[model samples]
Target: MSTVFASPSENGQTSGATGGASTSAASTPRRSAVAAVTNRLASPQTINFVDVPAQEYYSTNVFTKSVMKDRLPKSVYKSLVRTIDSGEKLDPEIADIVASAIKDWAMEKGATHYAHIFYPLTGATAEKHDSFLSPTADGSTLSEFSGKQLCQGEPDGSSFPSGGIRVTSQARGYTIWDVTSPAYILENPNGTTLCIPTAFVSWTGEALDKKTPVLRSMQALNKHAQRVLKVFGHTDGAFVASTAGPEQEYFLIDRNFYYARPDLLNAGRTLFGAKPPKGQEFDDHYFGAIPERVLAFMCEAERELFKLGIPVKTRHNEVAPGQFEVAPVFESANVAADHQQQMMLTLRKIAEKYGMACLLHEKPFAGVNGSGKHVNWSLGSSSQGNLLDPGDTPHDNAKFLVFCAAIIRAVYKHQDLMRAVVASAGNDHRLGANEAPPAIISIFLGDQLTDIFEQIKGGGANSSLPSGTLEVGVDVLPPLPKDAGDRNRTSPFAFTGNRFEFRAVGSNQSISGPLVAMNTIIAESVDFCAGRLEDALANDPDSLNSAVQSLLSEIVGECSAIIFNGDGYSEEWHREAAERGLLNLKTTADALPHLASPENTQMFAKYGVLSARELHSRLETYQEQYCMTVDVEANLAVNIARTMIFPAAIRYQNELASTCANLKVVGFEFDTETLDTVTALVKSLQDGIATLEYAIADDSAVAPEDACRHRCDAVLPSMLSLRETVDKLELIIADDIWPLPTYQEMLFIK
Candidate 1:
């Protein structure tokens, strides 16, 4: 029998990896870290991977429809499918039968326990396992599974951030099964456990987790989308769902290097490092040949993901040296969001087996390209196809334009909310950098769509401009392929061929928050479109085409200011965007507060997505998150400077002075330039450390908003200034004396 162990409890952990406390930096770590890394490179961790075809393990661990059909009574199976299809409440009568099938399948797979997995406000998975074995009649223990247990679970909520919805004394929180997301078994060598996706709520029935709002937003979108289909003479009953293909980017560094860097251990980023001699300047890392070890890790990760039914599609080296990206085929927004979390967890776990650490922080290293989750978002039904897809049929094309306008309007009006959802202290470092989209939010409608909208703005689009080909000078090369428009990599939100790629979502963020905003805002826009057309249809009782044209023209014209096909990174665009009244919120402090804006509160309430109180709570929760994140990073900076960098520099100076004194005694000459430079750097490092320490203690703001501003204005800049001094010292200090791992060692050694 395989070893069996239950899943761990939530215990009310904080968000992501940011925290106030961590292991102290070693007083003399360089020699040990370097020796460890050298030995590791000589005899690296071996991946004894046995390759298997994807089909062999695809969804093998999931209690999917096939399993349901085989084990459930035909009547029960069909009934459950119907409810799940319509997003309706599951029938109480069928719960027992469904739970039995799920339990049987899990038991057959050698699972002795099951966990109710839910995404809490902390932006991470929370689960506590329960054994199947239970006390039964006649004083015997029997393995049992029941409908009640499968449906609901109570976990302590007092420890999690509820944004004031649930006080510390109110400890009761409920996790209810989310039927839309399927159940799968998590395989560990020690044991297997049945994992059910669930939505968490407080005892007072407020959303205490990310999944609930996403589900609610889907319903809101569906209701308005059905009206659009009803007017156009299609199946109004068919459910419309937002789909997402979130491309995750991260860095993989040797575990030896990871263990040596206290800042990386605690802050999820290097607080100090000099730029390596050879960086990604050659543009060679992007699409470069994958290292053999990294390839093995990717293959195993994909294999594990395949078993869980995540259709991972792409893998390649990203623009940064140590950074890489993985993307999956599009799936329902809720499932994709769930799978994204699973993907991150799996990557981290697998990296360990290979003696590495996967860094998901948006900017783990300062001078290199940071990671971002580019979410390709669109709306569709299996029956009607993608509403955003511009089909060949003129009628289909017209509907596509209407839907396109809906997106434009949604983004134009709610750009602040879009920025707010992706706000974090970690992400703040990435945005507005050359590698990422700027802090200002704008839409990139490609040439074809932009042309169409331009025509619409002029009254009507008589015809869509064809995607012309580009001709290469070489006769052997094929002619340029048909494409409506060129890609804009720098835009925060850009409409690709069939979907809008939201490029501003930080690598570490949960896609749920962004998906919720996208769904809700688009739903409101669709409703606005439907309402306007409904008015025209009722009054005229004819000429549907004219009404659509008029509606398209108005939406396109009103929302035209948000459509920027130019470069987002340009200074000219920033000035122009400001002239057009677009917000350029450069920091989390400038962005997150918009969540509680009266208009946003009203919108969330109107769509039944979030109550005013719920929205306020989220604002408070994220505000606290932002504050906590900076506090941790700032503290780490101070500790590393005082404990690690300062000591190393002093030791190097003393060693140098001793050597120079001996050289002079022996009638030899030494360059005083080197000594002078080291001495100056040591003095500067101490001064920088003092400035950072004062910034850390200077906070007097009681309001969350003011606290965030203080961090943004005072703490962050102080940290950066100190980093500048520390990084310069890293260049001058002897490598043998430097306390932490260098970028070259971490980025290229693997």
Candidate 2:
């Protein structure tokens, strides 16, 4: 056996040597790689299953209402519940009692340190830890947690990405306790820490994080929803809240592969790799049997989440190999957003223990199904459950139509805003691909709902489709009752029974942005409907039902363009959508600018969701993020192609040249076809690398939007060209000499 020398790069590609005769030198890395795979496969994890019942383990570390009631005085507990339930201002006097109870509960859970965790503008969770130990005068330590410390914490804001909100001189920021989101104890093998959920803000009191906007949007939504419900004769004072159930999708690859791939390590994606022959084309991976190793990882991760009060409900194989999904039951939008972040952190942490790395990138692998966080959202109050649910009666159905009409109007008027919320360089690769939803933000009200809306537009919706049953061919199978509507997987926004699933949200993104946009736009539409309905009622008090029907009719007729039940991914639908005057903001560069449009500015300002300054800052930040992401990926492509791939190709070419020369010298004719092909590809690769290098060297300072445009126009195309040549080379290169892990190895080996 010939020894193969492999000099892999940071991203796991052999950069130095291609082929060598010394077996020991070449076999070292090869032996390591093979050993990694063998060890992982043979030594499966053995999780020690705890004997405790699930109900007892659930929410054990959380400071739940039950815990609060048990720890705090009756008066304090009642006061806190009032504030939580009614969304009223918290009473400062009760903070001491609440803080003491929370501290006691956390201490009982074996926590000695506490941290105020906040969601910052970087689309990630941020925290600053503090010890509970306070030194006494005699040098003894006392564990003390004050009310002021529990309510607020000052962290240096200059380090975080504030979008220029905080200057160097003004580096102060505060994390204020969000009572709605419960505090929980984060347990590690070494110790446990009390994690308090909070909202981050700058010194100027501007909204500096995602949670602030989400909370404000929820308030704005509740006000409008309450007004509409009041007009419909519902006088209950319960707070209306938006609910979310985000289905998180991710990929799990062995840690050895992750550490070797520089592109995956730095950019969260593969910059270069030939498409695998056995991709997701056959659709065999979707909902298939879970690999034993992956199931064990999922079980341990779920157990950790359960203790933290995250109600994770479903886990299964996704459409692509190595990809999977986990969904949780619905909760209030604020709490669900927090739990979604926690779930992502937990998955990544637990995967490490299982010797795997969890990938949350939107398109971790090319030519396969990408990941998306389908944010299932709905609005309701304690009094009127699930405002979007259409009950079995005519009156209930009419009420549902009114609320649904509000969503239709919201989507029609603010499709650009919806597209802007999910805009990111990573997500741009997934959206409009065959695997995910199209970039055009259209609402999918299934067959039954579409018919009802059409009838309303004509004049009134007198009836709805009745539920049917499905009968299998075999007599042994039981009949399954059909749902009111069939799901349209291609639509970006689909009405899935009781909730509208925003399918375009990227897996790695925070749910707060999408929830804020959804709530605010729906609030605007609801307010519009309320004003019109009030006017119609004032004109003729006796015809309330007729007035409500007329209002819905007008809304349906105006916003009908956004309601598309057909194939959203089809060319015909694209053309028809354009004919209907809908905007298809395709890329992050194209969609992000819409965030600062005058209409969006006014909407955010009017609803108190975000100020004009904050909105513009966010747009700038995203544009900068997009430009940076593309620039890094482009640079990686050029480096890998020039240093790692080009050398290997040349070495192989040298081997072929020497072989051809020797054959001719020995009086034998040799075909030069292979040599000619390799030469031509090398030349093209050189040309592509030159173009990319030139594109990246233009270091002119410009506006953020202009920078993003340059990246999209020049840098991106050059990167793709370089990748095209390199991937082609990968297909032709010798297997043992190829420096990087093949798609087959990465995607299928596990």
Candidate 3:
């Protein structure tokens, strides 16, 4: 049987199946998408660049040390600065003075209310606003913001997902200000509000938010890292801290196209999109010229971020069309996490104003590169800067070698924990897809470091590789200094000169969870190393260098299996990893169960990062999230297939039948091939929809793990089957009569 595939035109117009002119009777969505493109193209938009430098407006809205010093008393400023810089406990007496100063500053900025902002388990920021007004006895209002209000807030916790932390009857939760992260003024056209970063906890003192565990992990890491610094004979009474810089990636689509698709709106991804004819195949989009409108939106978003103390430093076009990336300067992990949330918010808000919708979904469109947040992490101190940096002579830099060895051991010991932290419903769609890293966690140490470690494991390393110079072929170009080694983009955890970049984190996920896991695991490794060094030094005080060398050699030999310099996306790597006894958890359901393992529980508990009960609660919550996400997507596929796609296909089928019948009446026999194809596809779609409905309606009581399995094993496959038939119908039906927007229109039109 000969088949005709009704491919869409460049502008989304379809050729009629009956060998006649295309009809425009049912092209509402397509017409709308086209109009949006035309309108945006005709009217170019530009941002009004400010005359002042960005440095002038940097941290203007933030309550930073400079602002506090200018506003508060000298004594109060000293005390607060000590608490912030030295990790000293806050003084209660300074709270009222600071609150008074903050209220005055906010009132001067035309503020009427203040909000205690916290990150909830829903992976979104939550806030509760309270007016800074109190009625006097004489019926007149007085501006009032007390120390108690500044420090704590009460929000109803019953509605938030607690995973058994807070029962229904126990609806009380408290938000305490996290002084480590500075407060900022969120500006609006009508009014401005003071946004204070905080940590949420239940009445029973259990951590009910992501910030608490992150703060605890920071403390644990700081304690052990300080011990290591002291052992290295570098004790300057400076506090050690972990720093992070997260690179965010996302897609931009026209608002009209976004609103027309229910799947994109509800599931944050397209449930039924056929592969477009052109899709990032030429690799021309990576670092290509930025579109005018997208650049404008990025500029305005960066302006907002700069005013709020987020040092957004880089922006560029990504590997996929309509996809882009932005990165900020490094800061403390706690503050960087807060800044990342604000960056996402700013991207979305500015996109709306520019007639677009920012998509942070890991895989919003299929058959293309997805989004990921590469978190650059490191440890540093005021006294000993950048412990991870391997200077010119890495073999002689014993301190740096010891720290690098600790990282390798940590990754080898807690690979499951690293995977568990980044596991989520959205991430499962991106990992091991040839674009992002594989599900198995591995470290990428460049040639220099890898060779040094190999030498150490074999015996001793007395020399290091020299930096080479790249000589350009042309006389006009000058020779440049080459890096010690080439970068490995395929590695999930890669050493990039002075820091490690975790490339497996999802675009839409908060960085706090991954940071917490990393810090806690490293703390364990550092503590173990410090104990060994102390014991060795006690045995032979004069042979300190020999003892350090021996310890590092042992660690390198044990943990060298996780260091890979090859492609992580290769199938051979997957087989080799399994042979090496590494875990390849391919899905959120497969990975989240590791959070409750005995080793993980004991590790977190020993490091004071999380209790067993808290860990269990987190695992349950994540599993439930995965199950619900799959359930929602399955139902949406069934609903759209039945209500929208099937009707369009049937309408076209009737048109084909009517045309054939009229042709027959006129004594002209018509070909039945087009009608037969449509008829068969429609029947298949109906059958697939029925099977999906049955799968969704199973409604049996089961464990969370079992529910996740049911959703993945049964419901997801059924939904895919339905999508296959529906997508096939999309290609065959008349584009004028197709109800949904085509992939070409959504992806290329922008």
For residues 69-109, what per-residue lDDT tens digits would candidate 2 score against the true structure? Answer: 88889988888888777788888898888888788888887
lDDT of 1: 0.87
Rank the models by TM-score, top first: 2, 3, 1
Reference-based TM-score of each model: 0.94, 0.96, 0.95
Clashes of each: 0, 10, 0
- Full-model lDDT, candidate 2: 0.86
Worst lDDT 10-window in candidate 3: 1-10
Name the best candidate (by lDDT).
1
Q: Please, what are the lDDT tens digits per residue for candidate 3 over residues 1-750?
A: 211111123224321111122335554665655554554432333334555777888898999999999999999999998877767888889889999999999889888999999998888999999999889999999999988899999997767888898877889999998888999999997999999999998898888898999889888988888877777787786767889999999999877678778899899999998888888999998999988767777878998999999999999999988899999989989999999999999999888766678999999998899999999999888778888989999989988988889989999999998999899878988999999999999999999998899889889897777779997799999889988889999999999999999999999999999999999999999998888888888888776788788999889878888999999999999999998888899988788889889999999999888899888988888889988898889889988898889888999999999999999999999999999999999999999999999999985848888888787788888987998898888888887777776778777775
Residue pairs that clash (backbone atoms under 3 angstroms), model 1: none
lDDT of 1 by residue, 156-198 (tens): 8777899988887888999999988999999999999999999
Candidate 3 CA-lDDT value: 0.86
Measured with C-alpha atoms, the lDDT of residue 79 in candidate 1 is 85
Worst 10 residues of 1 by lDDT: 1-10
* Model 2 TM: 0.96
Error of 2 at 673 (Å): 1.4
Roughly what TM-score does model 1 have, to 2 decimal places? Answer: 0.94
